[model samples]
Target: MTEACERPEATAGGAADPGDPAADRLEVRAAVFRGDDGDRLRVETLALAGPSHGEVRVRVRAAGVCGSDRHVLDGEWNVPLPAIMGHEAAGVVEAVGAGVRGLGIGDHVVIAWHQACQRCGECAGGKPWACTRARSNDSLLPDGTTRWRDAGGSEAFPYLAVGAMSEAIVVPEFAAIRIDPAVPFDVASLIGCSAGTGFGAVANNAEVIAGESAVVVGSGGVGLSIIAALRLAGATPIIAVDVSEARLDEARLAGATHALLGGPDLAERVAEITDGGADAAFEAIGRVQTMAQLPELIRPGGRAVFVGLPPEGQKVEIDGLLLAYEGKTIIGSNYGGLVPARDFPRIAAAYRAGMLPLDRLISARVRLDEVNEAFEAMRRGERTRSVIVFD
Candidate 1:
């Protein structure tokens, strides 16, 4: 497929100077997934178009390797291929497009994957997180086009609309939420996804209260963030369950009050620790079995928040009778029910105040070329999070 590189007409703020030939295009190194038989990522030089109207060009500093990106790699989530993957990222603004405001060059930003259309009902209703017009999942910009093309001129979609694994990217103005320059890019990268989702699940979805008990299933980055948020919410006995003891250790450091190895007796162990069941349960890994097990891990009338992204077409069978009889609730939280414009700064502030130990979430720092190794480590459950640091 071919696309023209014609610049959109500038608006009030004036877009990247169309006459300045240097501002029109850039050649950058990006990790492109071809969806070939082996499903590996290739670092290729691609042509990156400058930001269009209401967008900004960013030089990616750091991006977190997340499970959602893995799902696309593993063919569980069928996004457009020959795509640039990586959503949770931090970067510096290099240029702004027409109509852009409140952000400019050199500003540090967290790349919010979900660029909600403000006019959508959900967005207008103050729940931009649930905006009906989000197109990131389509891997295209709001205009249904991509800014990346290979040397051969084949269009490459940006995974989740950010494609942050690249050396540089162009994203919607709303997607690039500015933060304090003092925040490290590695820590800032996580606020876009894992940290935001985990914390939002507790504060918004579950409405976790002080002294309430909670259990977090899966001790990955998102799970660890849940533990930290639970602690901040004054929740007691924050139980963390994981199959890997090493991850459980990480969970403890993230503020889990009790750690339990996950297995057949996991429920019994959690019940023992919480004296029957916890007040809330968070399933951060999207395995069907674990998603089904969430209701059992919480007390009657408790909330079960699903923070992880399950493979497309996958379904879990919940006990409807038990759910109705016990007055339990199951909530699916997308992007942590976050409004990037609002929550990104709040998360940064929390990090600055030492309320969120975000640095603990970074288990490894790898270059773009070493990203596959990072994924391997993730497959072996050896990392809380691996960040790809750009030069």
Candidate 2:
């Protein structure tokens, strides 16, 4: 873990003044994605402005390399260039800006990519997961601006608002959720995105009841997380499918009752295991073919939860007639329909309690300079989750 920086005295409300020049000009090393195919991520020294109003500065300890980040690297998701491309991370608060209440310097935190505007209708209606204002693709902060700049002073965007790939970052107070210090940063980092998303999909979106049957169509980090949550939810006949035998073994370790290799006959095999079909089928891989096969893998009234994110502008062609005839529901789970402030800590607690095998999800730990290699491992289906750990 990175040592917390020297704490600056807070003002009356435990909030640091944003006008401090020293705070405004903090420099940090970050893995930058310039959107060029030849140069995916280059380690560079970047200047970061300290926490502004309703924000906090975090010294990142560990950041996970996710498939969503891979989407941007593969040119599937078009995000702003020269951005810090990471969202799943755990760190410690180094400074607090004006009006920051729930967090203070030295508090361990998990960075939430979706920093919902609490005043929005979706947030007010108790569905911050569907917040209309938190744009993950924009790469800009909630206020539509960036805190990072290059050596030549070119503004750089935080890929998904939190930008955990950097050594340090400034994010909205809501984006930094406090967690138990006992949890390891590397394990806690997966909770920020993959674990939280998977658990939320089961608890919030699918609402899988005890004895319910579920089939997870991917055994990657997020897929393994879903399998774990399904077990905790008391689901039965939990089947996991993936192309890699290694990930299938991981799925079994994460609580999959059965593991199967993904192929053209995947749906047929899942049906054979669950009698007619599973009560719920989760598509964790964002491929069109796998997503389209979800309906076939579930029972008549079963729900198909789309937990994986396909490339932007890509559409899946599900059989509308079949869906209507069978009364099957398709749910789109964004960030697993998670409310970060409420769910991140709960996930951390689960991890500490041994309810979730989060540490097993990390297949490789690399430094910031080796981020591209980690992503390549992900591309080759050789990893469950790769974390970039800072010194």
lDDT tens string, model 1, 1-391?
1111122333223335832424778999988889884757989999998777778888999999998888888888888878898999999988777666556678899998987787878988879878767788899888888988898999999998999899999998778888989999999999988999888899888999999999999999899988998998999999999999999999989999999887877778888888988899999888988899999998888888988878888899999999999999999998888877778888899999998898998899999999888888888999999999987
lDDT of 2: 0.87
**In angstroms, how far off is 257's CA in candidate 1?**
0.6
Instruction: Give TM per candidate.
Output: 0.94, 0.94
Q: Write the per-residue lDDT of candidate 2 for residues 313-354, one digit (tens) a residue.
A: 888988999999999999999888888777887888888898
Local distance difference test, each candidate: 0.86, 0.87
Candidate 1 residue runs with Cα over 4 Å from true position: 1-23
Off by over 4 Å in 2: 1-23, 37-39
Worst 10 residues of 2 by lDDT: 1-10
